[model samples]
Target: MANGVERELVLLFSEEELREMSGVKRGGEYIEVTCGCTSHRYGDAVGRLRVFINGELEITCECTPGCDEDTMTPAAFEKHSGRETARKWKNNVWVIVNGEKVPLSKTVLLKYYNQASKNGNGSHRSNNGRVCHRDEFVRCNKCNKERRFRLRTKEECRIHHDALAVANWKCADMPFDK
Candidate 1:
């Protein structure tokens, strides 16, 4: 919409070109770093972003569960944004596949989550000033008991998962052999 018109072709913008485009920012690679189409208030006819805690990013469409997500490089993403494609990644808006608007479901994912809650499949998390992971599943050979090392759901599961992939890690749950 640089000229107040929606182009039929996706525009691959250089950093300079993007800086001049609407709903673009100056601090990202491939796609817009600061914002995406899903949450853009300016009505960007492109995909939105979801930056993970580990700095990974994903381009998500404005649809509910199981809806197709558009994946492409920055250039291809802009190309598909054309009105002719029909699969539109409108900013802060809904997705339009083949000229059909894809509505965001208010209960699809929520329904599954509610079911998970009722089953008690993910409702136990206790910290004892140390790690509190499920020991029953991974009982140690020496103690034949569950060891706490940071795998609880409520605790920092993600951080622990990342940190555990190291070459040197001493298990506090492991008893010192006397």
Candidate 2:
């Protein structure tokens, strides 16, 4: 039973992964746990796992770029990815699915996940950039006229909104130059 538990720990967290997550110095004496009662070397083959698995050491997520050293229990660590998986993205970290970036409007769903994760949240912007949906009348500064713009959904709104944003005009009737 002890060996099986040890195997699970090794499978879940490699020594390197634990080191990165713990934010301990490379060649220091055995690092101390949060409780300050137990300590183990980051590279220890068996003792490292014992420190973590036995709950003698608390696993804090120090790997993410802006993480605040949030404590991640062994179970939480197992449920999430480690530092190595973070750099796999060529560009910014995105909520990709099946090798495709999810759309901007769908970002609300990702926000929900971020709240649940209680740790490093995914990028707030989409690859497409900011997409604003306006469903009201606005006075155009250039033409000095009121224009109505209504965008009900994300899919139907991005292109139109992006184009109007670049042109810096409200609607066709309220053209910028005119």
Candidate 3:
């Protein structure tokens, strides 16, 4: 946005999809779920995925040191990419269709927000306050804006974060180059 507000996209999924990720398990806890071993553009595997008792998902990107780490609502965890064949487990928008996976609009996503759930994702940015970096968001004090830098190297994000933390940067300065 011109104002520098990050675009927060919270995906939604079907109930069946949640069951698939969680495998019809216990309740009220973060159950460690297996995530794809796909090699991220930056580095290693995609890290871990967890489902809360209330049907929320927590994902961490094992791609890099400062990779992805965030929680998703049941709705997002259940969305089927509609492109999967044998349900190749994913933590993002794509879910399994033959089982549980479907798209829901903003109104539709919010509608299900009120449903009772254990360890639920909670609002899941149904309002705002979600980041947008590495698939998660990062902030910049100098620009007074928070957005993705798309830094090529893992060190870039770390440096950018450090610069921001130490207030050693100016909005006019580039974190490095491009």
Best by lDDT: 3
Candidate 2 runs further than 4 Å off: 1-134, 173-178
lDDT of 1 by residue, 9-116 (tens): 123333443343333332323233322333223344445543222223345443345546565532334343443343332322233333443332221111111223
Candidate 2 lDDT over 86-137, as tens digits, reads 3222122222333444321342212212222332232233347653443555
Residue 132's lDDT in candidate 2? 42
Q: Give the TM-score of candidate 1.
A: 0.21
lDDT of 1 at 132: 38
Clash pairs, candidate 1, are: 10-78, 37-48, 37-91, 38-92, 135-146
- lDDT of each prediction vs. the true structure? 0.36, 0.36, 0.39
2 or 3, greater by TM-score: 3
Q: Candidate 3's residue-wise lDDT over 85-107, tens digit each? A: 32333333322223443322211
Return the TM-score for each candidate structure. Answer: 0.21, 0.18, 0.25
TM-score, model 2 to reference? 0.18
Candidate order, lDDT descending: 3, 1, 2
Q: Clashes per prediction?
A: 5, 0, 20
